[model samples]
Target: METLAFIPSPSAGEIHLGPLPLRGYALCIILGVFVAVWLGGRRWVARGGQAGTVADIAVWAVPFGLVGGRLYHVITDYQLYFGEGRNPVDAVRIWDGGLGIWGAIALGALGAWIGCRRRGIALPAYADAVAPGIVLAQALGRWGNWFNQELYGRPTDLPWALKIDPEHRPVDTPDLATYHPTFLYESLWCVGVALLVIWADRRFRLGHGRAFALYVAGYTVGRFWIEYMRVDDAHHVLGMRLNNWTAIVVFLLAVVYIVVSAKKRPGREEIVEPEAEAEPEPGTDTGGPDSADADAAPEGSSAEGSSSAKEPSEDGPGRGKPSGGKPAGDGGGDGPAGAESVAKGPEPRRKAVDGPAS
Candidate 1:
């Protein structure tokens, strides 16, 4: 008998909670999302953004990401659900398994763009703030693959090799008891990538989406190697798995973006979220009551002081004569006379006969 040195897979990947079944795959994905949002929110706040912005944006991103991931998986593995003897209905059962990270990220970014537009936030700045969290989410999500007993590598006798259940074993490899734990390897690699991105972001002060680009590049580098080790059914091109080619292309593109972005803009963004404009009061101006008083005071004082001829002639002691009976700054140079005239009020006009005074 061969000596077995490996970790046993979970008997089942689900738990029943009073007729409601909770799948380990779904739980991992959900937990990863929460962690990502929590970490992203903190980073965003550090960049001078409002709290809960990441969660608000996630409302849109999450659904789009789920749908996109499912669509990519179905499209790429159409034979699994649409070919002869395949059950088409299985495609709708997303809880079972299968999610493409590339598609999820692409569509999720689109959704985030919509959210950022509505919230008046800069997408590039937000992407940088959330990059590390996104990678960590991926790391956490890989555990789901382990739970499902999928994504294993070639048979091996290593101590950390994963023990596959007879029912879950590959049909051609039914005799094999253990295999390389590709899922575990990817999970560990992703953790390392997350840390690297975080450290690089802090050290280089990466911004303008460069940090996110670095994350993509680093993740794809790990994925490229990890994908090579996975022996699952997949489409191949040029004797290589399709994902291997995708990883290579995406990695190169991400690297190019980082280089180009660093050259175009060399510093971190000063602000991530837009500053909310102070709203004007319903029945008042934004300048406040003091400003209103200042504005009206000058107009009211000027009008009252200059219109003395009209009001004083009709009612006050001035009768028809003007106030002081002399313009300001006359002889006496507006000293005592100006003060005395003001205290005594205006001078009245004298009543006179036809030609001369009677």
Candidate 2:
């Protein structure tokens, strides 16, 4: 029972601030969310997206992910809440702990899709940008399990084993004081997954959701082995845990998607957000020849003015006029006719400029 080093479970998962209560589980989840958004925003901007786009999309994604995570936990472990003499209301108490990563990812993706569609962003590009951040968030989120003292693995006497309080210990292992800290294992695994995704993404330039798929595959690989060590109650299928099966299926799907996506889309997206393409650079001509003509109109007016000045002589009052005091051309004189000639002079020059521009 004696261990040289071990992680001790928190005595209490929540602390009261006067009348307010702060749960460590909730705090960890919140901190993870902030980290994800911050990192995702940076990566998104690095990929030519707007600064706030990731946070904006997360507004939709986070809520949906929380709800989906809760729903998955409640449904999968229905006996804990909906069974005989159980209070179904307890299912809504997510602060107590329990969230399914699979459900969170599935529904969170739907939310992200909605946000990306509204913002005119490609979902695959957004997924690729945020993939590493998402895995990092999962790394932080696993600490929530540590706070709750739940989801520990089989009992162990190893130096790094987690010490569980008697009250928190599973009924079947009443004498065992230490168990594998699956939370820590999963947390560390997620960090590794995040690093792997970042390195591979940079090296291979994964796009079209391939980076996201790589994260899924890497995460599920760890989850499958980690899930095997957990002693928590779970539904079993064909002698294997339901989650194990889920992990296998998800991993295979992720691998398949990575291969197919890489073949279909061979490079990283040149533009993550469509709005970037629409923004015109300063001093750049985005409007074509008509705009060029408008810009040149001022110069043409100045030229016309100079020509008009030269046309009239500085002799007597009627120097340029004929003996009968009439203008030479059909343009009446220096009145409306001269004004019209000056105005029309720019038209021919404008047309000449337009020819090459067109």
Candidate 3:
């Protein structure tokens, strides 16, 4: 049968620019990372997290995710990189394309955990904020597979089939020209997953990582079916591909987490970053050292006068009047101590407000 139309694979995966080679696969991955960080940062800020926190955390998560993805691909498909005829060094060439989403997410979460802990942020809240962006990143990253002309499915003459190069075609089907575009299928599915996550998160007000869990479950459901379509050589168990089994396990786990987490802690987190919480109202007594000092002052004595006497002049030899004209102990001045006092102003405390019960 003559093919009417189909997607054409790229003739070359890399381009040269002044002796520097830029791989399409690498470009896609890089673009995906930037997009993820941008979107995640917005979501995080909306959730009361500090702006740019997602990008800061991405510094740790991205590298760990890349390494984990490459390791997973090499380990699972050892025959492609190991043995007498294969080159072990090729395994490190990630730009050539090959990444396992499973390993990338697993290790990426570990990296995010480390980043979150350093920032004194909760991992679940961070995950919830970035869930949609992560899946969107996967959607963009799947284009890498399209550029490399790998991971196509069984031969088909469908209009949307992918035309594989003769050299890239499976040895057993050298005569076949077109095959199912599993990469496109997965990419489109990931996009849908991202949309679903965003909608569900808003509609249900998912929290405690439940938004991330929803994305995981939704992606796995698509992966289970998409993985079945692929003809690429992969380990099989009980007549099903290894990834199929993985999808099943991961889907179940995600669902369990969503249900249990909702029961334990329902609704979204009121405060994503403790440090970003609103400070006590101005002139409101915070019960800090300053407040304690004011309470202990004599009944007729002025608290400000007593504080000025106890606090040293930040500028010169005067206590109540400084060279800057600002009163002493008022947390204003160019001096180091005054600057320190201003910078370390009372730590903000979260106001308690009960969330609706699940």
Best by lDDT: 2
Pairing residues by index, what is the TM-score of model 1? Answer: 0.80
TM-score of 3: 0.80
Q: By descending lDDT, how would the candidates be arranged?
A: 2, 3, 1
Cα error, candidate 1, residue 65 (Å):
1.0
Model 2 bad stretches (over 4 Å): 16-19, 282-291, 294-358
lDDT of each: 0.81, 0.86, 0.85
TM-score, candidate number 2: 0.84
lDDT of 3 by residue, 68-107 (tens): 9998899999999999999999999999999999999999
Best by TM-score: 2
Report lDDT (Cα) of residue 121, candidate 1: 85
Compute each candidate's TM-score over C-alphas. Answer: 0.80, 0.84, 0.80
Model 3 steric clash pairs: none
lDDT of 2 by residue, 203-269 (tens): 9888889999999999999999999999999999999999999999999999999888878889998
Better of 1 and 2 by lDDT: 2
Off by over 4 Å in 1: 1-4, 276-358
